[model samples]
Target: MTDQPSTDRLSEARAALATAMALHEQGDLEGAEAGYRAVLALEYRATDVLPLLAGLLGRLSRAEDALIAWEQLLAIAPDHAVALHEKGLTLHWLGRTGEAVAALEQACALDPHNAIAIGNLAVVLADAGRNHAAIGQFRRALALQSDNLHLRHQLRRLGAASVPFWHIPMMNDAPRNDAFEAAITAAIAVAGPDARVLDIGAGSGLLSLIAARAGAQHVVACEMEPLIAEMAQQIVAQNGYADRITVHAKPSTDLAVGVELDVPAQILVSEILSSDLLTEKVLDTFEDAHRRLLAPDALVIPRAATAMGCLVASETLADYAFVGEVSGFDLSPFTDFAQQRLPIHGTMTAWQRLSDDHELVRLDLTQAKHDAVLTRLRIPVTASGRAIGIVQWMHIDLWPGVTFDNHPDRYTDGGWLQILHSFPTPVDVIAGETLDIAVGHDRITLILLPLTQ
Candidate 1:
């Protein structure tokens, strides 16, 4: 009968499918792909063939094509887990982060047990800087797969990325904290309780709290790091200053006049100075804040900052600066890879000052604008020795009579450690000869270079 012929045709199709699978197993990808396309052309269980085709496309690095294939597969089987997951990954690779996050979130929702989907979602969230949500997703993934090394590493990195190592000790440092508090109180007294206060880089929310305690009625603080911002909020609440302070979890660059603050602040308090003075992008941050966030006559706390340094020679630090011969190899040519300047605890280390304390760099926080700067200077050498590097420190002019500095001679155990601005190599300079040096900041980094005269 005619029915017999139709049955025979079905049998032939099944046999062709079997041959296609066999070829696929034998590494005949092109032939297998052709066979699969043929089978799909017949509309023979296209859903089942979709995954195989998608995989082949992915293997060929045709992510766009694979994405289209997955979209078609998901249309047929809306709950298709693998299609959803693969589409999410492909989208992520294409830099379509928002959509990729949505798709991956759906995959995880469908299969809560899928650790891979959970981890991918967490990673995407972190990439988007939704760290608080990413932290939760990471925790959920870790709960599912407790021994996952990658997940643990991600969590640790996120946690540590927010707070610098100096924050805790800086918060607990009585002398430094007292000096800043006294200065903040004085600033608030001058500006009055009605002064619109803006605290940039609100680490531990300490300065903002001090401003609040000094009778500031309204204070807006910002911390660039989300984790620190969250912690600062908690700390503010704990100290009962939450009513007076408003913490914005964003960088100062993200702040707007009408949105975050009602108007330009009357007083601006920011402590983002690094040990090397300019490395923390302090100059740029302050300049932006002054130009856009502050009133014309805003009282900028620590109105000025200076980078102080002394030329020095040290045998202990020379080993860290140069690498010439190691294991009897002539790697002296590779000494060019050494760090030009290294941050060291000036009081903790022993190095003679070959030059007096000279101002290497200066930043006026009250300035409304800034331009990238570099200057050439001649440092008079006072001692005779193999000069290793320069020992540097910071002096902050908070307010009149309220100043704080980690002088290399006396201050110890605060957030700031005196930095050893090491030279590239041992340069022998005798007394009465001047060392030519270049100093400046590229808005984000401190540049210190020794020039040959």
Candidate 2:
């Protein structure tokens, strides 16, 4: 380290570097790049000159050449934080996602406290579709640079890309929260203070905190998203319940009975139902919990969930589900590729119910096993129009005498929104006709479509 020449110790190299920097600042990029290369070839301050040359190359859209310059600098100093960080950015520009992530990850490791480096790593990870890891890195960067709006914007943009926009509003739903709190309080009451509780999908640690506040001593919670899990841990600790609740950054299926938990939990409280009720993988997570992470008789919150819906007709929703007769052409076949399901504010959106609400699908969470269910249900039409699809919502049986639903009729302004399951093509129906529809789930998604027969 002492043998390393400081800028003041290198008279000739420092003068050359000054001239190169002047050329760079004066927008003589070509001249600057060549000067930097000439200095590096002289065995001058390569560490200094390489950065300029690499950055100039990148600016000139020579990302591959910039990458080479960065690699050369890295060879001389493998742990150089700037080299790794710039190399990562260059790799990202070149669409080398894997290499970008590797470089950025190494940069973050070398300069753990550098928020910019961490943020760059997060960006690369997100582009690579490793969203969970990317979120964690952005959160870490945000923690370091709290007032950075750009970082905050990136976090929100990436978050929206990864999660549903309703999550924030859903967390703000006092009715939904109260239902879970009451159920959790009751579950803890039945299981006793010492009963261990497992909260799968502990987003914001709300359920776990409710369990802790209800006097449950040991609560183990797992969230698949690393960033949310970390935030949950922080929120739990901030509220002084860290001692009672442990948050694990993993999916419940990855949890081992004695490893991540001191034994199978006695009570399971999870709020993971999607609008359609299965897209969040609640069935898979809960079944795994029952098999490996929960006590044989563990009380499950939301013991059951049902997808309830009715036939609907709406031009507003129809526009979203179908497109045809654009200006003056028949492109009706494109409807085959239209979105199958769409989420909308049921009360806010104009829709006419053609039939009374019917049960579409139900899941018994208390049961340890579940298979894909497909059944033919008949919807007796009461009003007739162009039947776009079924507008569906959820009815969650949280506990005895405590239930919640985002019923499309009276329920408005909550985290939940009614989802429209569009048909392959709009079907015209008349009153007093029963629409035979295939209504069930394929284990992971709800099956709601009108049957041709």
Candidate 3:
């Protein structure tokens, strides 16, 4: 008699599960959920009913309930790939990025051939700001599903968005490229054909290739951006220099002398100088390279760099630097939060010089360490109205005679632009008067402050 009752209960559970599935197909999620729970209460196919209940809860936007259902399913079937993937998606939707990445990564490992899981994992990774890892995952998913348009679009978007826009133009910059190549050849000639060269910030492996072609026996290049580093490796191979050059996806600080390089590098080539000359952490990077990765006297490219600028007054630029009455309302207080630096294409912008070019600051890369600098500069104003700011550019001394500068008057169509370091407030000045200002660097930024006399 007891056996007969157990049989009756099993029949009842099976009927309930059938009814729940019908309700789910009919779009009655609540009814389906109730039926699935009743089936689980009977302990009949709980593993099967748990997934149904969890998916229904997710559809109902009950994420917490859905998570509980998924955890229960996982407890029953620990290796359930689908359950893990769904749980990861839920966690991502709930803004639990770290946990989501962990879960999806696990799912991808369990079901390596599952394209959906891989793509979803890539999405979660990108959300976590792991762009290069995300790109790698996306590429893997795309390789599995070659005709997937969404996957292709994602790769293209990441390539365009994550990288700075100036990289392409910078590569196309013939004059700049020539100057760097000239310096690289000169350094290689001095260091000899067997020189071990280290190129920091190797975008597209251009400089590494230059060193290899210039007869350097070995070249190790490092780029912090993983996506860019991957491309650099590919480009180096495509150009038939893979045997001579190796690119690492890491910052210069992460590279070591014995591991990335066989020994201390004889030449250290880097083009990390920002338009303002210090914003790229050039001083810190170079100092670290010198102390850890380079020989006693490494040949540094662009041995010294200078920040050159002149005082400027422009009605168009004044509007950018300060705000007064806007639409008949006094918004002058907002001027207190004006932009400190504005990048402008010098030839394209209309601005008049109020003073001759002045050397704002200079950085010697060979130095092992640097301290914050502050100096008082007396400027002899020649033509002045309302001085808005200083228009700054770069002058790079590559070797003894080879140099490059993006001067406002001559350098056009290059990747770099003149940076306007705006004053705190517009200062009215007269021609033939001297303006005293503080000009220097805080190791990472060019400090230009107009002083009151």
Candidate 4:
């Protein structure tokens, strides 16, 4: 009972589709596009033709047209995963990042097992500055497809971009890890097994994990960087410490007594100090934790830190700290704009100590308040040389008996690097003379300058 007109129209539609496919295969994209449009106009198998048409448009660099095709397909089948995924890509191409993320998220949700969809969603999320969420999604996809090199590359890329490069080397530092473990163990031994612990700046969740492994029953940790916090959560879960440790992707100041913690933490373990001490906001972080997050008499790891330094003279370091002339130009004025602080690998660098090590400044972490400190330092010169800067390192008193320092003498491999506090200019001195210099911190950065003549 088929009418001749209907049968003929159907036959014509089939022929048009076959020709369109042949044209597409033969690299005649315009011809293929026309044929595809003609078939769609005939209202024959539009669903099957949509993806092809959209793909061809994309290949032809017609993003707007491709987006329109995907939109039309979505209109027909709202939950179509392919259409949504393609639409997300098109939106991203058009610089509509928000819309792309929304569309890609929808696609990922619809196809939970699709690694491609999940990866694309993660890419868009990262682009939208939702780094934490993006890291989580990428991890989920990577878990499904562990052999995907691209996924691994992206995970490391995001991590490296969001975190400092030294984090990995620091984590790999066995000595540092042992010291922190000993401190955490000591804290737990003193506070007992039921002591509640708070770890601030929980990078890689290592310190928090240490607390958990050390048998702290209840622990709360927080990190301000969303990407780092999210990765920490994964690391904690992977190490099977997720039950004991809860990571808040917020600053320590954002935590509260009864909200983020059931009670004020009884032991506060934090390692947020920079090479110079206060640059990582250690003073602010510890102060805030003491005021709000920690108990009145909470045990603080690394109860004190000392800035240890010795006058150093190096022809090599002088080049890094000062520039006098370049290509016949008196660039001595440029020395005024030289880096006030420079990180140095003391063992690898060519430097001679002009004076023995001395304590430039020290901070008691047990205290809750801090003020700017400035004082005079008298360095007893032993070897006569051009003193370009004061080479400084850290001595952390993690516990009563456990002290650690990255002294330029024996400590060579670790996260800590010797810092050079360059003088306004080089100073000439002889043996048995005292180099009077101003030394201390402005509560944020160390201040070092030789007393000008």
Candidate 5:
């Protein structure tokens, strides 16, 4: 014979819970919320009833009330995965990114097999700016739910967005690959099969693999991008060069002679030169390698690089470099803020040369140190018009009898593009006249300014 009052209280609580569920299903959120609170006041199934209340509050856009309900549930059931997951999502919606990441991480750990919870954690991690960790979690979630388009899109958005679009075209560039392979082969022949080789900016591990295939016994490679480095490692393993090539996901500056490399490298291979020759900080990287990582007599591929260009006049390019009145309004002041440099595929854009090619700047990579330089250059005009800018290309001296140039005339389908060094304003000149300009480098950028007569 149970106590009549106790049994009556149980029956009332059950009835209240059933009514709350029915109201919630019928879209009466306010009534459902009241009924849930009534059940909680009766001290019945708090762990279960709190979730219903918190979730309803979330739907109602009452984040503060929902947070309070979730916190109350967490206090009673600290290890509850559902409570933690919902709490984390609420915090994220409120822009409490750090706390959201912490809570979601806890939920993920508690429910390791829950792909949705893991993906939620990844979202919070991304908001917290923990990109690498977010990438890891996204990958884990993808492994379980590979067909989920949202997870795949997020992964690609983070992973592929950081990689330059030119990487694929660069890899498929046959002429560039051939030139590098020839240089690597020649270098290995001179240094012998057992020589130590170091590859800087080891993108996709191509250069390191080239050295390995050329019979170099040991090779060390470094890439600063973590995702790219992982791909390079995978590619190296796929090509059976894993034993000979070691890829490190770090910058060249982070490498040490005795730690990453067993001995000083006898051959250094790198192709960090940008289209402008120095924009990639090639001078600084080479100087550091020469000082710390390489042997005094180490042979450096692409021993010298030159910035070559010819004066050009193009109405097409002028439109991109200069601005004037638009819709009866004077926008000429915007011309003063024009871009100093623009990249264009040589074959794709229409432009005419006004003067012959001239050397703008040259970098001797073998040199241990470099200083900024500026010098006056006088270019003889051939067919003169409005000189909008100079169209620039690169000439690389890889090794003896091995050189590569992406001259706008003969090079196409390669990664490099011809740069247009635009003048602030166009200069009109006549044929058979001389155009004098100052040319040099500030260690990272080419300087080409037309001198006022």
Candidate 6:
């Protein structure tokens, strides 16, 4: 190249870079992107400019382009922490969780003190369902910045996600525990010490401990939540049942006949029922156990669960269930965003049931498979008022002699609460009338709707 031409090319590159920066500041993203591309074509500080271009692409919601730009930057500066972190975030947004984790791990390794990178790594790990590794990353981040609220929240969320929903209330209710233990002890006498026990959803490893205390010889337990699994491990050791019970930190879906257990269990005990029957994926979990994890004719604990609820009318709750015009504005349309389900502490909340208790849904836990379900029914109103929603509870048949429930009428001070399944809109109902409703499961969620009547 001639000296004169090289000088002209350098000047042009500098001018393009300056114009790009100015346009970027003015929020003219398209103009800025064009100028940056022109500068990059001249190969002037391409590594530095690449990150800038990638960031702009991300802000523009052009994730795929952003990812490509970041990957190119990484090719030039392989250990660049920021590039790795950005690339990982982009990958995660693209739903490529495994690659996202690998990139974030590299970022964390290169910059061990970068709390942001560590936090991102933890999140992607959790998204990939590697809760144990996610917990480790969270703990490492916490060790560096103990007072980080975001990290603490993540740790607690993961911990809670691991525990079965029923465990919280069961832990809180001493009376219920006593009743269940008494019934379990009786059943163990009939099942005998030689029974091969399987405890699914082993929250704090309590049920397995109970079985051990009742003299069962072999016990296998599986917990879907990692934090809870760790806690259950500790509790089992403390209770001296570690030798008898083997706790697997995985869902029932991961268990196998000859792998996790010596064989399919003879007495299957799982306490995974949510306050609302279908919300916890209990139907799927139980079916998997019956089909693969348990032997034929295995004695399943909580043999069946029924979702019991009563229609409710409350002016206090109507404001929560619906939105309407106020102060001369047409704001009623905001009601479309009302919550489908609201968790309420049964004893703490002041609300009245307006109809007789009815069965909303029932799950037979012993079934080998369950088809997706939605059904329509009519609920009679006992009082004349604005019907806001339905307050629902659970009834569990733990074993032949054992049973437990969080009845909205009398149960108090439990971790599990009677949830308020709100209607899409407030409906005016007269005393002694009926409201037609639709109820079912969308595989992973419970569906409740008040039909037009």
For lDDT, the strongest prediction is 5
**What is candidate 6's lDDT per residue for 137-231, written digit by digit as tens?**
99899999999999999998987775557576678688666656665566678778877888888887877888889888888888877777878
Candidate 1 deviant stretches above 4 angstroms: 1-72, 89-102, 108-116, 125-133, 139-153, 325-337, 347-352, 369-382, 431-452
**Candidate 3 Cα misplacement greater than 4 A, ranges:** 1-5
Query: What lDDT tens digits, residue by residue, belong to model 1 across residues 291-402?
Result: 8999999998988888888888887777778777789887877778877667677667667888888898888888877777899878999988888777888999988888
Per-structure clash totals for the candidates? 2, 0, 0, 0, 0, 3
Candidate 5 global Cα RMSD: 3.1
After TM-score superposition, what is the CA distance of residue 132 in candidate 2 from its true location, in Å?
5.8
Alpha-carbon local distance difference test for all models: 0.84, 0.88, 0.91, 0.90, 0.92, 0.82
Candidate scoring better on TM-score of 1 and 5: 5
lDDT of 5 at 260: 99
Off by over 4 Å in 6: 1-131, 138-169, 369-380, 435-452
Instruction: Give model 4's TM-score versus the native structure.
Output: 0.79
The C-alpha TM-scores of every prediction are 0.77, 0.85, 0.94, 0.79, 0.91, 0.70
lDDT of 4 by residue, 297-325 (tens): 89999899999999999999899889988
lDDT accuracy of residue 448 in candidate 4? 92
Q: Which digits, one per residue and each the tens of the lDDT, describe model 5 over residues 363-451?
A: 89999999999999999999969999899999999999999999998887888889999988899978999999999999989999899
Candidate 3 lDDT for residue 334: 92
Model 2 clashing residue pairs (backbone): none
lDDT of 3 by residue, 1-453 (tens): 123338889999999999999999999998999999998888888778898999999999999899999999999888899999999999998999899898888898999999889999988888888888889999999999999999999878877877998898889999999999999999999999898999999988999999999999899999998889999999999999999999999999999877988999999999998888888899999999989999998999979999999999998988888999989999999988998999898888899999999998988888889899999999999995889989999999999999999999998788887899999888888899989989998888989999972
Deviation in angstroms for 427 in model 5?
Answer: 2.6
Model 3 residue 131 lDDT score: 85
Clashing pairs for model 4 are none
Better of 1 and 2 by TM-score: 2
Model 2 — TM-score against the truth? 0.85
TM-score of model 1 vs. true structure: 0.77
Q: Which ranges in model 5 have alpha carbons more than 4 Å from their true place?
A: 1-22, 34-43, 127-131
Positional deviation of residue 5's Cα in model 2 after best superposition, in angstroms:
19
User: What 10-residue stretch in candidate 3 is worst by lDDT?
Assistant: 1-10
| Residue pairs whose backbone atoms clash in candidate 1 | 344-419, 344-420
Q: What is the lDDT of residue 257 in candidate 6?
A: 77
